[model samples]
Target: MSKRKTDEVTGVETTGHSWDGIEELNNPLPRWWLWTLYLCIFWGILYTIAYPAWPMISGATQGVLGWSTRANVAAEITAHEAANAELVTQLVAADMPTLPQDADLNRYAIARGGAVFRANCSQCHGSGAAGAKGYPNLLDDDWLWGGDIDAIMTTVRHGIRNTLDDDARYSAMPAFGDMLEPAEIDAVVEHVVSLSSSDFDAALAEQGAVVFADNCASCHGEAGLGNREMGAPNLADAIWLYGGDRATLHTTVEQARFGVMPPWGPRLKEADIRAVSAYVHSLGGGE
Candidate 1:
């Protein structure tokens, strides 16, 4: 090897590296920093050996400690479930109407039901249960079926207009686009609008009254009050499922609406269904 070059000014050795006239100093790293770096490398090796680190084709290498975050989480879940086992049992068998009489059961149901609602019902009914355009609001007294706790329970268990469950609440509005003239449909739309609003054509509504009585009154009632037995919504209320606007009303009248809610009875546990029902009933809308 060639003798190392020394800088005359600083009396320090130069590394083999150079650029233009600048040369690199062959200076040693600080003793503390070097020792710290070596300690970090040793600690990293220990960590890899003691805890999970390397990924394999099928899974990560299970370290010597054999500890798992997943296993810990599962254990915690099992413990919580064990604690709530009695309350869940009570919730399943308890009379729905008399649920509020038992404060502990009612509280547990609401808390558990809220979690179920957020995970399942929130996609359609909204996180706050205020409802979307086609979905019914749980916070209001207006219900297409009924607002009582029993009614709410039945609706939750069976659902509305779904084919999956045999006991599902079923109803179908006729597509009047195929049954009636366009002018006749428009007239009926105006009449329906007149039920909840003052901004409607008198002439159209008058003609539509006769049409409504013949076609819609059986399900909607003579005054458009709606028949809950038939799952018909109250038209007099400003709250609309699809909408009460003229355009929306016209589409609803012409094409008709067939909204479907999947049965929860098959998917959720009996206790869960009851809990969700109780939770819905407590939202100020249930009678």
Candidate 2:
């Protein structure tokens, strides 16, 4: 038979359960532990009273402090705006050409521009400014328009192929399908392809040169070198805007693909536009 033991300090009865000769004693919780638990409960009650707490029919209780998540966000935004006011003012006052000279202002502009580019320009001119086919790569030195700071600013302010902007870059490559015979376009394509390589057939080039001089030479130049003012691409360069294949050239001559980019000035803030233009200008071979 096992015997039960009572706790001498509390005069409480034993649990009457024993394990491995160790008997369980029914003792009161320690005063300190009990007080700590009570403190937690009291703190919870105080927190409920001081902060937004119980849900009602329509909404939760507005605590005594009247604090809200919205208020906290507004306060943070106000503080940030206050701090950036001087920088914003300086950026607005400065012109695009002079932005890069001011190191602090340029850094600020790039940061602002990066965000705007990610949101707007990243679809075509990727996040890193590496463009897809038909879209001009901002990273590369090859610009359809002039590559200067003022030129880039003008391009952004008035988008290319945007009919909405009356002053948009309006010149386009006319479809030679209606203008020239299929055989002639083919000969020109072959001649254009040959400009990049020494593999051109002299006889065919000689025959095509007459057709090119009459029709294409005005925009493409006498030697097939592109005209920037007319947005005509350089024929001799390895970097091709629309692929350098025979089929692609045929399609370009047949349909005459014109790509369009949106103007950022109307949608984005001036500082943000400046920053993005600077960032694009700083890309690989951007000068």
Candidate 3:
């Protein structure tokens, strides 16, 4: 048994751990710090016992409190839905064209519809309903189907060219790539370009006019004003869903476009669909 050495200068006990000429002092920890550490350990044990802390094979252990974050969130959502129930009913029942006549109901519908649009429609139409490259702008009067409130609602419900819904607005432009000769396609592209812009070859556009009258006039109308019933876009309008450039027109003539919109009728409630339609109608472009 080795006797613990003492530091002669301080009269304190030594741990007998030495490096070079220095020796380690056997000092006691501060009482306050030691008490704090003990309290922390006790608190941790209490927390584990009172709350969901342990993981079992099946699931996490539900503590005595029986509190759950998911349950709390679900409860909150239910409360909000209940609060808006009356308004939702009114919105669904209200005449869509004359909805704006009732200021309060219209306001509520627009606000609720805005939220719905942001969640579902914003991915394609944008947050401000400005639209992207391929997507048609909601803030424009150039609707391929129609821009009226009822028309907007109907479009939302059934969507465009979608196979899932039987009543989906279906329109198929013939992919002229296999049908038309390269020269004929080029001529048609020039004519289509001349409809919206002045920067087009006159001779080519003249040749294309014959081609347009023979093939495209049936759906696009004699003056390229488009048929809403057929969902054909007006070529005369500067607003283009794809693009108005020469190259874009060329591609459109050759391959054609088939823009598809998923039917919201199956996914969204009638009230929600109406609300979003109202919201879209209020975006300055609706007729």
Pick the lDDT winner: 3
TM-score of model number 3:
0.82
Q: Which pairs, if any, clash in model 1?
A: none
Alpha-carbon RMSD of each model: 3.5, 8.0, 4.1
**Backbone clashes in model 3, listed as residue pairs:** none
- Over 236-264, each residue of candidate 1 has an lDDT whose tens digit, in order, gives 88889998899998899888999999899
In candidate 1, which residue ranges exceed 4 Å CA deviation? 1-64
| Better-scoring candidate (lDDT), 1 or 3 | 3
Computed on alpha carbons, the lDDT of every model, listed in order, comes to: 0.90, 0.82, 0.92
| lDDT (tens digit, per residue) of candidate 3 on 125-144 | 99999999899999989999
- Which sections of candidate 2 miss by over 4 Å? 1-79
| Residue 195's lDDT in candidate 2 | 81
TM-score per model over all chains: 0.82, 0.72, 0.82
Give the residue spans of candidate 3 off by over 4 A: 1-64
Q: Write the per-residue lDDT of candidate 2 for residues 68-88, one digit (tens) a residue.
A: 998999999789768888988
